[model samples]
Target: MDTSPKIVASVVYGCCPTGEPTVPVHLPGRHGGPNRGELQTVNTYPAVPATAGFFTIPAHADYRASAATVAHTRSLSFLKPLMGGPCFDLEAIWDEHTRYEFADRSVEETMATMVDEPYVNHVPTLTGGIGRAKLTSFCRDHFIFSNPDDTALELVSRTVGIDRVVDWLYDHARQTK
Candidate 1:
């Protein structure tokens, strides 16, 4: 009598429910064969039908869908825990920094968001500083106090990403000679 364990076919689904759909992957293990112990290589397959309460998996002619699904899963693995959690509002942080700059407030608060030893570089004028002391001094002497009382800044756009926010801004101020 045959007592070997019967291997069942397993299906790997994609993470995205709507964007990128994946076919139901069928692994080889039904009958007792050479690939009974090992998983069969999946080259191509038809996508699983989209039913109520189920995701619509897309069919791929080649291995593109499999590769994309893997990439998406890998990218979302770390973000799963952070999703719907207390996320940092970059816009509000930028507003606070701007308020500190325009109101001539304490540079300490502005520098709080930065690392232990932070550096700033004004690429255009090649003027900035390194470390807390130098950066604070530069902000006080060159940026905050030096600007006119009517100075204003216009925010063009802001691009927020995983760990950084890129702001496009235009400063409007009267030059005093």
Candidate 2:
């Protein structure tokens, strides 16, 4: 199965004759990714309150990461000198890292997404650590393994800046023990 990431960039028109842009609500794909070039007709979303206009749907389907994002990353791997600094999709990188850490629950895989010397600081608990070895230890013994089996995060909002992507999430978990 293809688990790469897909890009959704299609806009649908609605009943608004005044041409005011309708609110866009992303519809989840059935096969883990939205089908490419397929038009999704949604009168009302399952739980979300649908606005009076059409709902925007995903344009591409079933992707862990888009091919364009992958190619951009690969091309940048060779242009570090010319660019002077890394130039890649921050959102894609963040998504990949989180997927490895939370969903896959692989400390090694999570560490592979970070740098040689990285640091993690949990502001609420004032936990986490610095350096690769310390961070890896934290992930193995404290962070990832400590989560409950039913843990999930609902992203409320995300701000992607040039150098950073800040995500506001709501943690939904029921402690099993």
Candidate 3:
């Protein structure tokens, strides 16, 4: 029942449920508002994918105006002020995003371990030339493992039986600290 995030941060391109909020249609011609005397038009999202939960972390400002860019760019344009706070579609997510956040900590921890290994070392420098498989692996591992808070990560790890992930990150970070 508790669907809170395992970690929290100013993420970029967050899900936008407001694009289709169920509001009382009491404004103008649709429900007899000031514009009742004139013609009115309503707006809605077009080209919805199979799922809405899917989205990508766009890295550039120009991409905000176009989804095709995200499809071909194959790069992460971090909205530093927002941190990927907009939502596109499932296909867009599949196209642009390499990493995603789940509600489980163990999943994130496991992902981190996988990403931190030699096979995934080229992720830190966010270049766009990497293959989709490699890029996605980085995304999943980077955010899931590289959280800034220890307490929160621990809480998530314990909740999801990631004792190993917790121990690994803790020990790993401690040695560096």
Candidate 4:
């Protein structure tokens, strides 16, 4: 039951029937091909019995396979969709959050968009709150209500992923005395 990663000395490339490598993977710090220039095909190899019309080319025993290569092979195109990434539109949900925070400036609306018992932590100023009650208080006191007269945000870039959306923005605010 040891789930920790162990060092691998070689990799095996599974090839399709067309002689094309189904997984054209190269493990870093490990060179391609076997230890000997004489490559072993399924017909010539005996250590591993051929199965399901697939064949493999074993790498050199002295070379070590990188951890990234192992992860890459497991997450290949054929398996990624089956792994169950998010199905909803994360960008639109995030846009609604921002709209509630800035445009509407309604603490109730902002909190409505979040899950129950959600938390926020402003890293720079270290000034957000945890839990439903505390976050609502923080939003009303220090965030939504404390904005300057002309405060606005201009998004520079946005990257949406399966679970989250990251946005780079320009905040335009004018101080008022």
lDDT of 1 by residue, 1-177 (tens): 024333222243332122222322223221232322222322222243222112223554323454445434433433433344345766777788778877656577777766789899989999889999999899878867777787887889988754456789888884568
Which of candidates 1 and 3 is the stronger one according to lDDT?
Answer: 1
Model 1: CA > 4 A from native? 1-86, 174-177
lDDT of 4 by residue, 86-177 (tens): 35676888899998898889999999988888999888899999999999999999999898757888999998755567799899974559
Name the candidate that leads on TM-score.
4
The weakest ten consecutive residues by lDDT in model 1 span 21-30
- What ranking of all candidate models by lDDT puts the best one first? 2, 4, 1, 3
Shift in Å, residue 165, candidate 2: 0.9
The 10 consecutive residues of candidate 2 with the worst lDDT sum are 16-25
lDDT of 2 at 40: 35
Sorted by TM-score (best first), the order is 4, 2, 1, 3
Backbone clash count, each prediction separately: 1, 9, 16, 0
Candidate 3 lDDT trough over 10 residues, lowest sum: 159-168
TM-score, cand. 2 vs. native: 0.50
Question: Tens-digit lDDT track for model 3 on 36-112?
Answer: 22222222222323233223324443233343333223222222112444434433332222223322435434334
TM-score on alpha carbons, each prediction: 0.48, 0.50, 0.19, 0.52
> What C-alpha lDDT values do all the predictions have?
0.54, 0.58, 0.31, 0.58
Question: Any runs in candidate 2 off by more than 4 Å, and if so which?
Answer: 1-85, 174-177
